[model samples]
Target: MGFCNSCGRPIVKEDYGTNKDGSLNDEFCCDCYQNGEYTEPDITLEEMIVRKTKEMMAKNDRLPETHATAITATFIPGLKRWNPEFQDDYKTL
Candidate 1:
């Protein structure tokens, strides 16, 4: 199964976001996208990494902070929403 390109959440059918025409946007999650718009348009990639790392630590206390941060650093940049060109195109979309 794939993950949400924005938040790294597992991409289950119910978690999918809607396109402008109300079709499923397979690349994003409902939390990150709604009605073809980013929920937090101004959030930067660094902010997202920091936020997700904190979330990981909160969800699993046993997870080390360094490990969470490392994972976030590696994963977030590669996600479609955070990719350099994709981020630019997303704003236009």
Candidate 2:
């Protein structure tokens, strides 16, 4: 018996079909094929609260949400590296 990673349902080998990557998986399950009720990406409570707070404050101030959201986001080390547009405009090479 194999358990579906996405749905937690116990599936028999005969019920499962091979995925393109060759993993034995079910053909009919929503999680198996991403048909419905997808799981959200894992986020910590701290991250969740910060995102909401920034969005809320931005709304009250009549400014775009990214203002506060960017501040919180830039503190996350490697995440800042991913945003090339935020790089210092004056720095050359």
Candidate 3:
């Protein structure tokens, strides 16, 4: 199993994104990627962190909002979509 490059969500084969050719992308999840493009290409890292934190809190009612935000902030930057070195790689795709 791998994590989505965009959302940092855990992903299996069935959760894999698709490329423009309809091949499995492996680097992202279906919700964050499709047809070789980000589902929310205009979203910034900060926005994603906020969104994921809210989603996390909603999914786990016991989870504190601060904790959810902290987790997503820490995890999302390391993802391929947000990492500077990986940015160029996606541009050529």
| Candidates' RMSD to native | 2.4, 15.2, 1.6
Off by over 4 Å in 1: 85-93
Runs with alpha carbons beyond 4 Å of true place in candidate 2? 1-39, 62-93
| Best of the two (1, 3) by lDDT | 3
Q: Return whichever of 1 and 2 wins on lDDT.
A: 1
The stretch of ten residues in a row with the least summed lDDT in candidate 1 is: 82-91
Clashes of each: 0, 0, 0
- Tens-place lDDT digits, model 3, residues 16-84: 999999999999999999998889899999999999999999999999998998899999999998999
Return the clash pairs for model 2, or none. none
Write the residue-wise lDDT of candidate 1 on 5-25 in tens digits: 988878988889888899998
Superposed by TM-score, candidate 1 places the C-alpha of residue 82 at a distance from the truth, in angstroms, of 1.2
- lDDT against the true structure, per candidate, is 0.89, 0.46, 0.93
lDDT of model 2, residue 26? 55
Reference-based lDDT, residue 41, model 3: 90
In candidate 3, position 18 carries an lDDT of: 97
